[model samples]
Target: MTTIQVGLYFLLGAYILFSIFFCTLVLFSTFADSVFIRYLSSTHLGKPVVYHLQQVVEWLEGPKCGICLAQYWSTGDMAPRVMNCGHTYCGSCIEIFAEQKDGMVICPFCTRTHFCNTIHPLPFFSENHLLIILCSSLITVNLWKCQTCRKKYSSQDVSRTPRVYSTCGHTSCEACVESDFTQKKRVVCLTCEGRSGGITVVAENWKPHVPINYAIRDLLKE
Candidate 1:
């Protein structure tokens, strides 16, 4: 073929491939939305429960906060909380909303009312440790593998602790590290076969433990 003809054929083929990719993306999005709607319809729960389940499913599929319209955060204030109606929201937003409502707060999505006592600061859905562990563990099971043990980390593990990620982006179960540290004074990286530089002893007589990388935890959950 002539040089110009060959170049033209290449460009045409590239355009066809790009068009196919764009169409596939659109089709996948539409299919996903339809599936979600069908799943919601199948659930016969109350509006509040349905709304919360939708949020949970959406969050599981892709991470984002329904309240603040921001991505999920694992920090103390920004952590995700579940409501009495079984919905989830960011802890910071729920606190502010509760205060504004004078301890009688209603859910915007499902219109469910929840009472808050800021004086005693009773635990909200966010404070439910078991729920937090299960949700976070479900996410962790999908994304992380314990480098040291080569096993998928689950919240249902003996300690039910959140998965710990090192500064090097390697993940390990809390049990494995604690066990190793209890037996040996130094924390070793299972992936690299060396001491992780980020871990340190904070106090005398206290066994050193690796810090939980909340960002990675949040990402996995999301």
Candidate 2:
């Protein structure tokens, strides 16, 4: 084979060889040292950062679990199961999913294949959950549920889907934020209204009767 082809083969062989070592013998050399749990959130291969929660802001942007609707948006030591399909879910949600699929564990989000690595909680799982949830409220750019109307809206929703952001960093999703600019009796921001024409109001200004679009939060997580 050509030199380049031979080098490529050698690299591939080395990677597979090392993967085997990590999976089987080298890591097990000492039970105390066999920190398999540490690697649980680490990507096995090319899995997206979304599959593994590490970065703070990135985690908030990860997709919501399709099954439970619980926000898995924070990256602070959250425990999860990554299926063979590259889909991830919290342990509780995964258990329910597995049971529904005859113990086969199909991905509720994709058709990549099905299998699970369950019970692999990180050492800091519990602590991280609390931290992230608490941070969710304090983060400046995060969404707030209108206490008056109980409608939740993010900063982005106030402006719109952000079709194209302006030089100053403001975005315009005309489809969603058009009414806010119109002279209609009432205008609603995309983040807080279901029907239309509800004025975009801050948490304090929002009506207690309106509702937040929970779905958009999920999308933002993704």
Candidate 3:
């Protein structure tokens, strides 16, 4: 064989070996990150931060409903529902389990048993609003953007704090509301106006009057 052919063969072998090494390194790094995140998730001190790191953990470990092993989403039957034991599962799985067990909810993870009213089984298992919001935020593009300014709301920016209008269920940032208040203009929900063909005016002092949406606030913290 020619020396050129031998050299080319040697280079190909080197390339394959390099590729294998790089892939292995990436796999190991991802595994380590997953382990670290799991450890953090287990600790009480890390509980607060877990919500923020939840997406990273989910990406590394693949988020799933503990009961049915289905991916969590924002709405419908597959939405996250929290049991009395504090473990979350898909709403469909919970409903099925409750039905089969005669309104008895046995948390698959913690093995805690809870009983719902046999007549109405759903009220016992509350919707995991925080997780639902998180899932929705993950799937939707610019879900937290201010309606007026088109700027994304940030937890760090107090001025950009998101507030939901009670009248229309539309969200606007504090900056936009403040701008309206400064000009003594009625703060209107444009989304509601466009949809309902009428102006929906939010209160002049909206911050104090509007109820805080804990779910959205927690999602923003993430």
Candidate 4:
């Protein structure tokens, strides 16, 4: 081969090798621990954060509170509470919903009645501890943003808005429900385009009249 042709061939081979090396470095950096740490640090939750693949799945597919139509907090006063019919709701919202039902609480989703009478005459609700841990893990990484509006679920504001999921496992906020109801006369799922029949006012005194998706929440816990 001519000298110039040989030189061109060598340059092309070097360029291909350099391109491969650059692509490999990019892929490595994408999954590097430092990159994970940068995301963790940006959340401002704390130090020594550990990443888990299962937690990521839970955070992406976790259930939202049917009442108030916001994501479940799963900690402190906002911890999730289960009804006799297997529906779940934010602890505080459930209390407000059941406050006027004597000692009986009704499942808004299934319409099944459950008794929450404390043997010592104290008030209480059934809590899902595993779900709470999953939620807390998501919060630590700041992945609590609602998939619908892309708005972050604020842990500092414990009383922030509520969330509800459709039968198709899609979530929507109380404000969206209200807006759509006023315009369409029914609550619509922004994700699946499913319609919630007969839901006139979902957010009444910060409580939604819809039922929670306990099944999805349980699955995440598992």
Candidate 2 residue 107 Cα shift, in angstroms, is: 0.7
User: What's the lDDT for candidate 1?
Assistant: 0.53
Candidate 2 weakest ten by summed lDDT:
162-171
**lDDT digits (tens) for residues 93-211 of candidate 2:** 65655556655556556654454434432221122222234335554223533333434444355443322111111122443344443444343433434232222334432222122
1-222 per-residue lDDT for model 1 (tens digits): 999999999999999998986675555445645765567556776445455555545545444456687644555765655554435566777777778877766777678788877542225433323224434545533455665666655544543243332322334567776766666666554444444333444332222234443333444433
The TM-score measured for candidate 4 stands at 0.35
Estimate the TM-score for candidate 2.
0.24
- What is candidate 3's lDDT per residue for 92-178, written digit by digit as tens? 887887887888878776677878765566655555554565565544322557658988876668877765543434456777766
Give each model's clash number: 0, 13, 0, 5
Query: Which candidate, 1 or 2, would have the higher lDDT against the true structure?
Result: 1
Q: How far is candidate 4 from the true structure (C-alpha RMSD, Å)?
A: 13.7
Deviation (Å) of 129 in candidate 1: 24
- The best-first sequence of candidates by lDDT reads 3, 1, 4, 2
Where model 1 places Cα greater than 4 Å from the true spot, the runs are 1-61, 64-143, 160-162, 165-169, 192-209, 213-222
Deviation of model 2 at 136, angstroms: 5.6
TM-score to true structure, per model: 0.36, 0.24, 0.40, 0.35
Model 3 score (lDDT) = 0.60
Candidate 3 wrong stretches, greater than 4 Å: 1-55, 58-73, 77-144, 181-187, 194-204
63-177: candidate 4 lDDT, tens digit per residue: 5676776667756666676543446678667666556676666777777776765332123444543346556564432344444666544424332233443233333444554
